[model samples]
Target: MQQEKMNRSLTLIPVVLFGFSFMALATVFSTYGVAAEISHGMVSGSYLLALIVMLFTAYSYGQMAKAVPSAGSAYAYTQKSISPYVGFMVGWAVLMDYLFIPMVNYLLFGIFFSAAFPAVPSYVWILGMLLLVTIVNVKGIKLATVANAFISLFSLLFILIFIGLSAKDILGGAGTGTIFNLEPFYNPEESFSYVVAGAALLCFSFLGFDSATAFAEETINPKKTIPRAVIIITLVGGAIFMTVSYFAHNVWPDYTTFTNADAASHEIITSVGGKTLASMFLAVYFVTVFGSAMSSQASASRVLFAMGRDGQLPKFFGKLHHKYQTPINNILLISVVSLLSLFLSLTLVASFINFGAFIAFISVNIAVIAYYFIRKKERSFKGTILYLILPSIGAILDLWLLLNLDIHSKVLGSIWFALGLIYLFFLTKGFKQRPPELHLGAAESS
Candidate 1:
């Protein structure tokens, strides 16, 4: 029998919706407090800077997808454009992100729910979310697609409501007494470095937009559609983040006053909409958290499955459930790791995830230059700008952001990368041969 292939019926609209669902519009509020404090009330500036970094990387992904529309995403881009060895390392780095995102969502869910119902412990809420997401992944996450679409729509409505209420409060002389204030974007007393630092953390909020490239095999006219979708998603997500954050800062300019930075969005919501609206916000938040947790858990398991099948780990991780046709072992393993969130903080987890993301982003940016500028020799002025100058700047900015990450993220990320290096050393027998190429079709689930 012929091997099955992904269906090629997804058009631009569906593909764009997939990107939106992956990168949830509601995430802006999730990190609002931390970013506001870190940026010195300049959360909007941080998001704007992060958007510039992502746009450059987005262009590279688009170009690579146009040239090599494969299911591997960043892994495939580096493998075919650069080399298999570089590809393996990049894949490993991205795996760090897929591994931790579920935990981030779990922790966020716990933070919000526990605050609403102080009678219940946070861990209980976290445990419940993890158990639900694990079961959904163990069976299949196709149902998650429909659920995510609904959540995505509701999240937009949620954001719009917040924006309107925030504007109303501003009119009533709250915050800076104006809807648009330059002070929130750049406070004179604080160093501009604060904005850059906040941008590093805020990158996590923009994580899902590039996922459009993963659907190349399934999208109609992928060379065109996928590239457009990726660019549009990046811009749209960035705009939402910047706008929402701008309004958030104006509604509450005193970030330092937040009782708990991690759960600050809750306070802002209640203040803006009062008790009844705040209660409604809590319900919608639960669904948003549920959708994000389930999808993230599913993606993490798929990456583990891909690595196991390639012999990077024990084959047990590669094996699917006999009846469910899913990676049961990997799902369970990730669930166990997610339990760590109960002991961790939000900024730390967000930084940990970005450590790998920046590496992957830098690698993809370099991969573009290596593929087009050197191998293909596109030496014309336009080609030089697109393939050389632009990508180099992207790499530099990504490196800067990587360095800006808190010391803990760098330490942990270094340890994670070091482990990958040791594994590669043995797998390649001391770099005498090429590393094994990963089968990334299933791993690109998100």
Candidate 2:
């Protein structure tokens, strides 16, 4: 019997939910302190700047999704438009994002869950989350998407509550005590470099929008839906991040006074709503992280499936479940790898994930230029501006962010790339020919 294929059952709303969940509605709480410190309390401005940079990249992803609606995402875009060799390397780089992000999400869940229930080991929570996400993914895309949508809605509710409480506290003569203030956007003490550095880190919250493209093969009317979803998710997610960060900044205007820079939002939560609400916020935050992990695992499995089907990795990774029509092997692989969170430090894992994401962002931006301008010679003024000039700017911004990564991340990312190089050597038989290709069905170019 022939193996089952992924069900083309996902629509625009589910896609949007998947993207939103992957971005994680609770992201501000986890990263706000660091962003505030880096930008000298200009956390809102940093997120806005990062959103601008991400929008440009989102355009490239949108254009590419229309051009090549395949599950490989950046890999498919690069392979079809640029060289297959480059595509393989891009796929390798993106694998780091897909493979490790879920781990990060689960690691975060573990930490918070363990905190809530101190008697339980963190690793136990991690394992339990891993199991739940894996099972949801294996069941099918629709189930996973529904789970994400529900979790996303609850997460959004909690965020709105947090913002409302913060606003009320501000009105009650706390911190700035007024929503109208430019202090969160700028301060004389903060330099341009500091804001840019903060923006680089803030970009992490926007990472999941691109992963939406990985569902191309499983989306209904993918060429149109995936592109629109990519842009919409970015805009929506950016709005949430910016608004929350703005109020959060108002609640605690002094970055230097944070007891733990990494846990600044914790203090803000307690101040705004007391310990009970803070505890409730933590529980909701865990749910959001769980949603994030589920979305990440689903996306990562599809990328592995795409790569496997194209013969970049073992063909087994390409196989869909006989009954469920999901990427069973690849999903299982990701679950196994996510176990690394048990042993790895959160700081190292998060930094390395960002490194891979930045590299992949650079590749996707360049792929837009190479394919549309250089290869196709579609030099119409609009095409030139959108496909060439915009992506160039995105690439430059991504490069700047890449430079801002810590040395440890830079080194580890380099090592991952080196391993990819070694794998490519054997896969291509010493670079004598192109890598194997998978036939994508019914791709419509925009």
Candidate 3:
């Protein structure tokens, strides 16, 4: 009997929008205060530097996606191009990211909404966000893409409004009283190391670009479309971040003056755009978080489905719903896991996700060199640069960021890695046999 497959209904446009959903444009404001503080008024430069770091890994991901267009993403890429042991470890590590992301958004939503309505319980909002994302995802990727499209459009519109308002205010004797200024990008008083530190933190804002690769099976053309979508998502997301951060830093020249760094965007928005725009920012930001959670949940489920189908976890997880042809089992499991947010704090959840992400980034870059350069022997000068030099830089950068993670993240991440290693030993029966994997003769799609 033939295996059930994903619906190949996604083309370039919807795919891009789906990626946009994950890299929500509004995220610039979400972390603006802390990033601004770290960069010392050079948040835009930090974001620009972060973008350059991510692009190299993004390119490596594109190459791997072209070679192995599997829903498992970094996990599957590492398994095929490098050691299966390493691939399993990569997947296990990134599962920390894919799994916790929705919970992070859910936690944030609950905290924010509950604050506004005081009467409604925060758990209610958290549950609602979870159900909304789960239902949308379970229905199908088609429905999810439609939701993603709408949210993506709204994000773009909101950013444009912000830029327009910020530019107007700056021109009208506000915030340095000029649109063009170097302070937002460079501060002679601030050391460049500060920018790099801020870049390490800001890299989380660009997480969604590679998540595009998770939908390879559902895409119309995995090889061409996924590659282009990954690069485009990175560039577009980076452009939005730099532009937004530039204006925001200029608008509020004194980052230290924020009464509360956590909610600093609220102060800036209300001050510049007034009460109406402030209200609009909150409302639209809520929706953007919803869309992002939905997108991340969907990606997480697909990754689980890929692993289960390969016999790494359990075969039942591989089974798609007969009607929707979607990973309903995995989706539900992720939703259940998200309930942990009720017990977990936002700071702890957010800290460890970046730890897993950068590890996966480093793995992919190294995989490019191992598979293309060493294994395949693509040794021309161009291949050397593309497959070796570029990926080495990417790996080094990823390692630097990984090391920069807070003590909390490093401690938690190390525990998670140790657990995965232990599980790998049992799964392979003391390393005597290979972990189970299913290699399809051809890619599957509708």
Scored by lDDT, the top model is: 3
Q: What are the root-mean-square deviations of the candidates from the true structure over C-alphas?
A: 3.8, 1.6, 1.7
**Any runs in candidate 2 off by more than 4 Å, and if so which?**
1-4, 444-446
TM-score of each: 0.87, 0.96, 0.98
lDDT of 1 by residue, 384-421 (tens): 99999998998898888888777888998999999998
CA error at residue 19 for candidate 3, angstroms: 1.6
Ranking by TM-score: 3, 2, 1
Compared with the true structure, what per-residue lDDT tens digits does model 3 show for residues 1-446?
A: 66547888888888888788887779999899999888887999999999999999999999988888888999998998888888889999888988999999999999998998899999999998899999999999889988988898888888898899999898888887878888887889889988988898899999989889989889988989999999999999999999988888778899999999878888888888899988888888888988889888888888888888888888888889989999999999999999999989998998768888988999999999988999889899999999999999999999998988889999998999999999999999998989976464576221
* Candidate 3 runs further than 4 Å off: 444-446
How many clashing pairs per prediction, in order? 0, 0, 0
Q: Candidate 3 clash total?
A: 0
C-alpha lDDT (0 to 100) for residue 10 of candidate 2: 88
Worst 10 residues of 2 by lDDT: 437-446
What lDDT does model 2 reach?
Answer: 0.87
In candidate 2, what are the lDDT values of residues 1-446, reduced to their tens digit?
34235778989999999999898878878899988888888888888898899999999999888888999899898888888998899899999888999999888888878877999999999999899999999999878877987898888888889888888888999998788998787777668777777888888889899989999988989989998999999999888888998998888888899999978888889988899888888778877888889888988898899888877899888898988889999899899999999999998887678788888889889989988999888799998898899999999989988897889889999999999999999999999978986566556473
